[model samples]
Target: MINDSGTLAQSHLLIVDDSLDELRILKSLLDAHHFRLSVAFDGLQGYQRAQTLRPDLILMDVRMPKADGFSACRLLKANPQTRDIPVVFLSAAASPEERLTGLSIGGVDYVTKPFLAEEVLARVRIHLQLASRHMDTQEGAAEALDPDEVLLQAGIALIRSRLGETLTVDEIATRVGSYGKKLSAVFRERTGLTVFAFLREERLKTGRRWLADTDTSIQDVADQLCFQNAGNFATAFRERFGLTPTAYRKSVRAGRLIEA
Candidate 1:
């Protein structure tokens, strides 16, 4: 049974959205979790309600009429009265850029739309618990991520944005404001691969996709991936796929190598 005798039941949640159907769906989900909720149809209304009620948490939609979630979050964060209230963005935009933007502008977390109900409940419970901890110990730090995690996240953002270009661990570390060794250690610890190894894997994965889909020449594909030269790329490719780039494409076109 959903408890009415816990922290979750008493915590007030404000959900800002434009879709009535989504509002109903979320309300039903949170109701089962026994969370008290207030609704807003747009960012402007959400901000107004936030100011008035100062709910324990805010669930924001990115795109809305009258105002957007980003703008409302900015306004809320600027005001001393509502600044500390945790706002989690529930948006359909799944790109890394979108998620980063929300985080940059004071969103505690960003959950993409079409989310699992269980995941939503889990995230809400965790954030609310964190908020409770902050109240107990008035640390009052601004955003959830500490410096090291921020650097790691920024490094990943850089990697995704610059996939086709050659990158060094030192360069990524410098960009994220850390040294190469520290970045390397963190990267290895989190991913079980050295930074260079991870980059090579990403490049090879892209090369595999292009070879399978496009009729581009092997040398041209190598050039597109910013490989040192076609020969080096071909050697790496063969080692990875058990076939030369030329052979892989030919076998794929001839239906000899079944695609998984």
Candidate 2:
């Protein structure tokens, strides 16, 4: 729900287009609305920016040099981190087919070029509200989301649910009704991490949490997380977090944790 101060102040918007004039106008309008903004000159840059910045919404132009807006949208939707972000396409093309293509590929709305300033603002606000509501109730909307997105979510859930197990990428893929090669490709495309890498990171994270919150010995922690022994666990932990498990636990207890 929008607060009394207005939700626009907390909103971040990404504008992707090739035209400098269009960007300038859109930037000015959104800035006046008190929305934080980021700009990308081409579709490729826009996709990269969205992945990193995670803006609340995107205003994408249909045509560009490196990658067109439609292609970029496809990549964004495939990525789990950026898929939920609302995309509003801004195109010079007024044809029904173009707008339909944008919506069919996961865009939330379309705004034709030479758009009215007020209309753009209204649409942006409306979609942002809708996106915010969806985020608040995402669990209920999970079944309606894109299948690839649902697949990625389910795969991550499986990994977390079995963090202590010595599971392989092939096993995870099969359990999720996919093959190793295909799942790995999707994981890389959607999360920028291979399944194996993600599993390793999750294991380390669980170890860190146990160290900070539990009195479990390092050896037991290692054993539970499926490491061969404490020595192997300590080595991997230090390499990942720049401290031995003992040191990390001590620092947390002392309430003077050093940067890792």
Candidate 3:
């Protein structure tokens, strides 16, 4: 089903490895599966190809001559141009800790060296399917919220109506799914955040407002945000706003800040 024309009918893959023999083997294996393939010999070239080709997925090697896969993955994740691209590390590093480090650095999956072709294909298929679903969700979200003002208004309405209650992804999805996935995508596209991220931001904003405007204690604010405990609430608040609840309240009281 894959073709060289770069359409959805054909999935495009970029394989990056220092070993020409390994690349050829992988290319042959994927070719048999009808995947349109591209190759890069090193991490630098891989990064460039990823940006220019915009392949559906990337298979990256861990250790290479210039710019290793981990560094490249971190670079790609940091760049807005390629942050959303799913990278799968095809490496000889088989330790659990090594695999975890690869994932933590932005690789979505890791396949060790000498992997079976079937296993490789299966993992590739799964990641490609997820990327396709994410794209579909984004497109649907855009179409649902063609009007920018309407989406913002609805998002605000959701915040107002749902505040002080624990929000779930399903709840947010249900509310936005009414118009279609397009609305959800539109909200994320416009705000540069997922539905969950937006909800968390709103919840934090509300919590900060309460802390600043009312005589409520930090525990109350945590409860208001439906956070399980004050510690979790404080951690999330600090991570989001760079301040503890008490510090935030003190800043607000001193007129140093308005909102989180």
> Which candidate wins on TM-score?
2
**Candidate 1 lDDT by residue in tens digits, 95-133:** 898899789867999999999988888898888877776
Best by lDDT: 2
Per-prediction TM-score, please?
Answer: 0.51, 0.54, 0.53
Q: What is the lDDT of residue 176 in candidate 1?
A: 47
lDDT, candidate 1, at 236: 95
- List per-prediction Cα lDDT, in the order shown: 0.79, 0.84, 0.75
Sort every candidate by TM-score, greatest first: 2, 3, 1
lDDT string for model 2 (1-260, tens) is 35556565568899999999999999999888788889999887998898779899999998887667876777677566788999999999779988997897789999998899999999999998888778877764322445467557657866886788889888876655456897798899999999998888889999999999899999999999989999999999999999999989999999976655
> Which should have the higher lDDT, number 1 or number 2?
2
Name the lDDT of candidate 1.
0.79
- Tell me the number of clashing residue pairs for each predicted model: 0, 0, 7
Against the correct fold, how does model 1 do in TM-score? 0.51
Model 3: residues >4 Å from true position, as ranges?
A: 1-8, 139-260
Task: Show where candidate 1 strays beyond 4 Å.
Answer: 1-7, 139-260
**lDDT digits (tens) for residues 1-260 of candidate 3:** 23245334668899999998999899889888777899988776887788778888999998886667765675566455576689999999789987997886678999999899889988988888778767766632222222343444445455565667776654543442223365467667788877667777888888877888899988888887888888998999999889999998898889898453
Candidate 2 lDDT at 48 equals: 81
Residue 4 lDDT (model 2): 53
